[model samples]
Target: MFNISEVDKGDSDLARLVSELDVFLSELYPVESNHCLDLSAVSDEQLRCVIVRDEGNAHAGCGALLFHQNGSAEIKRVYIRPEYRGKKLGEKIVSAIEGIVSEKNSRLLQLETGIHQQPAIALYRKCGYEICDAFPPYTADPLSVFMRKELP
Candidate 1:
């Protein structure tokens, strides 16, 4: 079983995983070219990140949640390694992020996925997120799939 752990932004394992996440995102969305979001430093800009690791020194999956208050937050870069997919590790990472949101007393969970990413859309929808009109900062992209779920 994989263990979900929160480490400092300086953690080496997390640094590598975040690098991989950045590279993957760049490949998926080449036009954005946002390398700043891939940094290991918290910069007061990121609220929190969650990293999961197995028996090895590498990460199995990783995800981040940003707090916007206003009873809302965004889930970003939820990723799992190819070998770990279909084993529900992605769901575990997602559940962990949602739990963190709940702890922060967030009432809404909003996320952006790509239209070309059908499997991810299915996973988010299965997790109770519903399709919604694109929100702020994402209005320019017609390919972006914005979704939100209300916390109980």
Candidate 2:
């Protein structure tokens, strides 16, 4: 069995996972193209995060949501451990984030990922997100792929 639950971004296990994600992104894109939030920003009290744990209670993956005052939210720090990738945990993490968005009354959700990240892009598309122009605090970048989804 696997469990997905809301968690603090500062949780030690989640932090470790985020660090690994950072490294993974850094290796694929230049610093400017890597929009991942740093530890401090991601740990803000208002940020909502979730972690996936396997049957034995080991952290398998993590993701977060950053809400904006405009009734929209940005998805961030969604990372699944390499060893745990094929079991649909990513879909579950995304579903959990969407649930939180609905509870908060947000209808729009968006994210920015690297252009080279085909798998990530595919997952977002599968989850009902569509490619879109860059949103606020983001600009058009050859290396960035922006997407958004409107929830009913």
Candidate 3:
């Protein structure tokens, strides 16, 4: 089992995971296909991040939710350390983020994951997020798979 808590974007462990997530994306996709949010964008007050850690307090993964002025938020920067994969930590992180979104009464939660990330895509689908048309700040990119789920 893992503990999940909301943390600032500048939190040391979260920052490190963000860096790792960026590096992983860079290795998998070309520059144009990479639509990750930079540090500055993540630092925006409108965004909130959550970190997952084992009982030993070691960082296992991190995820973020970007709150827009409207009643919607975008899920971003979700990553689990390689060793932590296959434990369903990613799904837990997404559920935790969804709880936060629900608290804010956000009507919808959306995310943009790379087309090559089949596992990630499957996770979102399992969480009830369906493939949808790209939204703001994101165009119709061949390499991007946009998904959204309506919150009850």
Candidate 4:
């Protein structure tokens, strides 16, 4: 069984996985475009990122459930390795993040995925996230998409 675990920032495997995430986003959206998250910028506590591993060896994917400590949180940097895609790993990560959001009393989970990521958009929709207006801090970017899901 694939297991998802809470990870600290300094882990080498996770650091490499996060680097891959950066490359994936940047290759799709340029660094000059100011769209992808700079994985090296913040410390562990500030982000609360998570990783899903395969049999406790290779890091298959990584995601972060970031909170403003209010009633909202952002599900950011969710990425799966190319070889590991289509196995429903994205949904599993989202489900794991949802559990964290619930525990934090967050009523809504927000996300920003690119327009070209149709599969990701479909996954978000399947998970009950509705397309919302371009929210602040992301309103000016035409390439940005905002979606949200309300928790029970």
Candidate 5:
């Protein structure tokens, strides 16, 4: 069975996954256009980091929610291992984050992705996130695409 739960961002295995995500993003976009969160940032008490594990206890993927004081949350650092993609794990991870968002009383969830990340974009839309204007800490960057969904 596949299991999804909140995990420590400082865990060795999850840390390695985050490192790979950073490298992948760095290679895909310029530093100026990348807004991917660092491990320390995700480790903050305000963010809840989650990991997916398979039946044999292998890490499948991970994602996080950054809680703001205004009852809103931002999804960040969603990464699936290269070998584990195309299995609908991305959609599950976001749904898991949405459950957590609702529990925390967050009324909205937002995220910023790169224009070149078609799969990520599709996943977000499938999860009900729609295109939105840039929020704080984000601007009108041609390379960036902002999306948000209201929690029901």
Candidate 6:
């Protein structure tokens, strides 16, 4: 069984997962197109992170949310280990993040992903996030795909 739960950004497993994700994105996109937050930013108080672990406590994936003062939030650093893909873990992570958004009364949730990340784009669409124009703090970039979903 896999378990998803909130964890400190400083958690070693979470850090490792984020580092792996960073390397993966760096390989696919140029530095400018990679909008992922660094470890320092992810450790900020405004961000809440979650990690997925298996029955034996092996880390399988991780994700985070950066809350804003306007009752909005951005999903960040969502990644599932290559070995753990195709098991609906991505959906679970997104669902877990959405639950946090609802708890925080966030009216909107948004994210920026690379255009080359087809699987990510499809997962976001499956979770009801639609393609949208670049949001604040984000300018238009050909290699970037912006998406958002309004919370109920």
| Predictions: Cα RMSD each | 2.4, 1.2, 1.2, 1.9, 1.3, 1.1
Q: Model 4: per-residue lDDT, tens digit, 2-68?
A: 8888777666777788788777777777555445655567655456778888885678988887775
Tens digits of per-residue lDDT, candidate 1, 1-152, equal 78887666666776777777677666777666342354444454456778888777568888788776365888876778778888787788789889988888788998888876788899998899999987765674666788999989
C-alpha local distance difference test of each model = 0.76, 0.90, 0.91, 0.79, 0.88, 0.92
After superposition, candidate 3 runs with Cα above 4 Å error: 42-44
Worst 10 residues of 6 by lDDT: 36-45
Model 2: worst 10 consecutive residues (lDDT sum): 37-46
Q: Residue 99: error of model 4 in Å?
A: 0.3
- Mark the regions of model 6 whose C-alpha exceeds 4 Å error after superposition: 42-44
Evaluate residue 1 in candidate 2 and report its C-alpha lDDT on the 0 to 100 scale. Answer: 73
How do these models rank on lDDT, best leading?
6, 3, 2, 5, 4, 1
Model 1 ranges with Cα > 4 A deviation:
33-46
* Candidate 2 residue-wise lDDT, 59-139, digit = tens: 999999998867799999999999899899989999999999999989999999988889889999999999999999899
Residue 135 deviation, candidate 4, in Å? 2.2
Instruction: Give the higher-TM-score candidate: 3 or 6.
Output: 6
Candidate of highest TM-score: 6
Distance from true position, residue 94, model 2, in Å?
0.5
Tell me how many clashing residue pairs each candidate has.
0, 0, 0, 0, 0, 0
Per-model TM-score on C-alpha atoms: 0.86, 0.96, 0.95, 0.89, 0.94, 0.96
RMSD of 6: 1.1
| Between candidates 1 and 2, the lDDT winner | 2
